[model samples]
Target: MSKIKLRPKSPVRLVATLTFLLISLQIASIIGQYLAHQFSIHRAIDVVERRISLDSAFLDVGNETLNTPANRYAIERYLERLEKVLEEKNLPVVVSEIQGVRTKSDLTEFPRLHRTTFENAEQTISISINSRNPLNEVGISWLSIILALLISPLFAFTSKKRRAQSAREEIVLPPKPRLVINLQEKTISNGIDDKVVTLQNKPLCFYTALVKYCIDNPNESLPPHKDVPHELMALANKCFGRLIELGHTKRKRPDFNANLDKTLSEIRAALDDVFTGYIDEKETYYPPRAQGEGSRSKQHSYALPSIKEDDIEIIGN
Candidate 1:
């Protein structure tokens, strides 16, 4: 007769747990976003750096083929192509005439607005392309995706452990007691005879005797004693008497057998009334009263054992 105590619910614990998880997720997401942005910026810078070198090489070709109709045509074609690319990427470019010759790498920063200069005998041409905005051009949604991947497994593990704890708390079953029964003697020490009744040549009288002793001896510790109604006691007595009569009968009396069967049914129903509230499938046994039978001076106490098929004992010829 143990009881399960439920823990009190706490709003603070719930709020705290949610806050901690949200903070962890937010921190992870922020770090991922920062990395993604930097990666995109660096990638755009690399592309622009390569373009700067290519522009320098193209301008050197123009300087080599100066003052020719083919040189003018090639320069115009190169300008048209480079301008078209810059326009498509939403970048700005400027062309200017300059005095000194310069290499593209040494002219200005490659990833920013920078100038690449080419010179010949009389004139110099300088082209400066403004770097494209990395933030506007690149998508970094994979930051969010990466953060989700890292947090999913952690959330799953926490949820699983919480569910397991809840399940354990919800269905706490009591421990079972060590139970045994003796059936060698025909008479008992308390002056009650232990009758031997047989059903289909197999003895079943032990059931009645054991039940009677449990019902009559309320003060005994072997079978737990509890409160039972008069109707249940009357039914139990009738069942016990019928079993004894069936044992002593001389002929094959179907009428007696039928009466005994009916009485047994009534007895089970009575026991159900007395013990149904105390027994369950997991912990199937009668609970002992805190106080013994004699402790209740005025009230009538009776032993109500939660009976199972194996509770009945048989050990004689």
Candidate 2:
């Protein structure tokens, strides 16, 4: 007889196997979305931080300190030190005339700055300030974006790992509470509180509500609704736009990953909500279902649909 061998999977192998599975199925693109999203945030932070600091310096660099040249010189000195640091790091730096006529004190601080931002594609640092005085904003742009870019991949990698683990766990789970109700199923959108239910046949009951208590009723339903895990949805939404950049299209049901994950999570949450609601109602009816105990736990209920009071009888009352 031919030997059929199944190798024991090591932790490394397990991770690798999941990675391979993801790649083979082209899930990398889905995951790559997080990287892109992180990059955007990093880039934005770099851009914004540098812009603010430089904008401030631009006001001060042309200081007309008069006899108070020391104060003016002190600020310029700070900026110069910053420039040297940037140069050492080989970050992008630019100085140009400020655009748009903006009023400011000519006393010594009206920098009125403008310049095209630049940085290495790999690093993506930009000119932090036009002047190297006061050093308030120096090199912050470079450091911010670089850190953002570096951390983005890690976040993306972590997200995929978590998703893989979650999928595996779900697979290992013994079949969940199968719905016995005739539910009115709904296709959950990517919102945080989107609700959906599926039964062997069909289920009953579908409802939509805002996901967060943080906002007014209308203010709720942020990309990551309450129906989905907040962290998961946040990470997903961060990458959501990037997935859209991956030639993803929006339909009644999104074909992309973040959207799909969000949808699935919300649907599950919705199902859980309905199931719990039903269980609460059914179980609350004392001696539930023909002098029998309730179909669910008297304490915490998981919300598996019941066959109705007249249907399946409890093994023991």
Candidate 3:
């Protein structure tokens, strides 16, 4: 029987997995803290309820005694003692309102945590705690820390496995195709193959001017708009003059500046014919296409970007 083998994960997949795990753990931690705080609030309310129920003297007091100002002050003092007890236990609760006895003016400013009422034939007492999510009341347990520590080693092991797999499956690509611009023949060729693309006088001059400009200014892209730069136009005119001197074209000097976009499209179409079915070579030799529909801004150079100046051999110029 053959042993089963699992494919190694990519770096992107590993990173995504780590990110998801971290986010999940953070959400779980927040939920746990919230639940712990809620439990503390309920526990504090229960303590208050038990103390009020156990106060026989207050419960047995007549309606007349409960209505008196002195009795009401004593009840407020007893409630303050209960607040101290809760604070000592790290609950941090506040007695905000008592129905028919006293009401806090700023009760609406604080969130209401709990409310309860105690009633008998003699009188009724209502209490409310208006403090919520007290600081330092909820804590992360040691168990959660231990769980995180135990899970970290698993993530490390998975990350190492992915890296090792990527190393094992690494691919080596062939060298980039070279471009050769022959000015004398007015031809462009991919040096890897015998395939050559011949161009007319004006198109050849425009293409060669752009290529030479790219070589000189390797870091800059041509303007995205229809307007050509003065330097590029000058370079194109110089190439056209050279072609005319070489007797390649009998026609007079053509306007290189007029209809510049149409000339760029013609140059790109010629390059496309030569590098057809070869996507990488086409990308290397072809002029940068427009980015989007009606978009004037160019993100890439108007000339060959992938081909380096060292790789391009310009002859007869």
TM-score of each: 0.26, 0.17, 0.42
Query: Which order, best to worst by lDDT?
Result: 3, 1, 2
Highest TM-score among the candidates is held by which one? Answer: 3
- TM-score of candidate 1 on Cα atoms, chains taken together: 0.26
Q: How does each model score on lDDT?
A: 0.41, 0.34, 0.68
Better of 2 and 3 by TM-score: 3
Return the lDDT, model 1, position 246: 45
Model 1, 17-127: lDDT tens per residue?
A: 555655666666666666765565455445544664455444533433455222554555555665466458643332221223222222132244545554445345554
Model 2 segments beyond 4 Å from truth? 1-82, 89-308, 312-317
Superior by TM-score: candidate 1 or candidate 2: 1
lDDT tens string, model 3, 84-181?
77668876466765544453334443465577888655566677776664444445555555565556545543455555668878866656666677
Q: lDDT: which candidate is best?
A: 3
What root-mean-square deviation over C-alphas does model 3 reach?
13.4
After TM-score superposition, the amount by which residue 171's alpha carbon in candidate 2 deviates from its true location, in angstroms, is 17
Residue runs of model 3 more than 4 Å from their true location after superposition: 1-176, 224-226, 295-306
